[model samples]
Target: MDFSFPKNERIKSKKLMEAIFTEGKNLNNFPLKLIYLPSDFDDDTQFKVAVVAPKRNFKKAVDRNRIKRLMREAYRLNKGVIFNNSERDFALVFLYLGKEMPDFQLMESKMTGLLEKFLKKIANEEAV
Candidate 1:
């Protein structure tokens, strides 16, 4: 399967983003917090996502950009954990929450765990 994170899979709609933050469920895993909304779609093969690094925490633009870049790379590499298992479409936002900068390994590990937790949570919700 193609693992590339293309433009189509990136969440770019302002209205949708606002709705996701206001109404979506959240899961936190230190360094990374995910806000997600499950929605019906004609094509279930795609997930729209965004990575965010808050300026309040990371003061410098370079720091924020680096965090966002790491988050995106981690997600792009590990996204199959969600894409392969889920039958529904999801809109997700990854929020960086650490007070300090994290290394690549830490980000990858946490991102994997976060995605696993999200899958379990979604399964539980659907089973209820």
Candidate 2:
């Protein structure tokens, strides 16, 4: 499976970003909080995502960038978990909330858990 995060799968539209923040449901997974919404898009991709590291929590720009990078890597590697058995498209914003920088393994594990939770939530929503 292709694990590359392409341009079409990155959330870059300003209006959609605003809408997601306002209307999306959020899931808190300690170091990360995910805000996601069902989205309408012309492309066939199942999900588009954005990663954020708040300046307030990560004082240094480098630190924030590093965290964002790690998050992206973990998501890219495991995104298939969310793609399987799903018909709806989604826009997701992953907000890093921790004060301290975490290692790659921790980020991967947390990301895996977060994706599992997200998929279950989506399934529940569809069922209801």
* Native-to-model Cα distance after best TM-score fit, residue 36 in candidate 2, in Å: 0.4
Stretches of candidate 1 exceeding 4 Å from the true structure: 41-45
Q: Output the number of the lDDT-best candidate.
A: 2
Please write out the lDDT profile of model 1 over residues 10-128, one tens digit for every residue: 88789889999889999999979999998654544468999999999888999999999999999999998899888888999999999999999999999999999999999999999
Best-matching candidate per TM-score = 2
RMSD of each: 1.3, 0.8
RMSD of 1: 1.3
Regions more than 4 Å wrong, model 2: none
Q: What is the TM-score of each candidate against the true structure?
A: 0.95, 0.97
Model 2 / residue 59 / CA error / Å = 1.8
Report the C-alpha lDDT of model 2 over 1-128, residue by residue, as the tens digit.
68899999999899999999999999988898899999889988889999999998878999998999999999999988888757899999999888899999989999999998998999999999
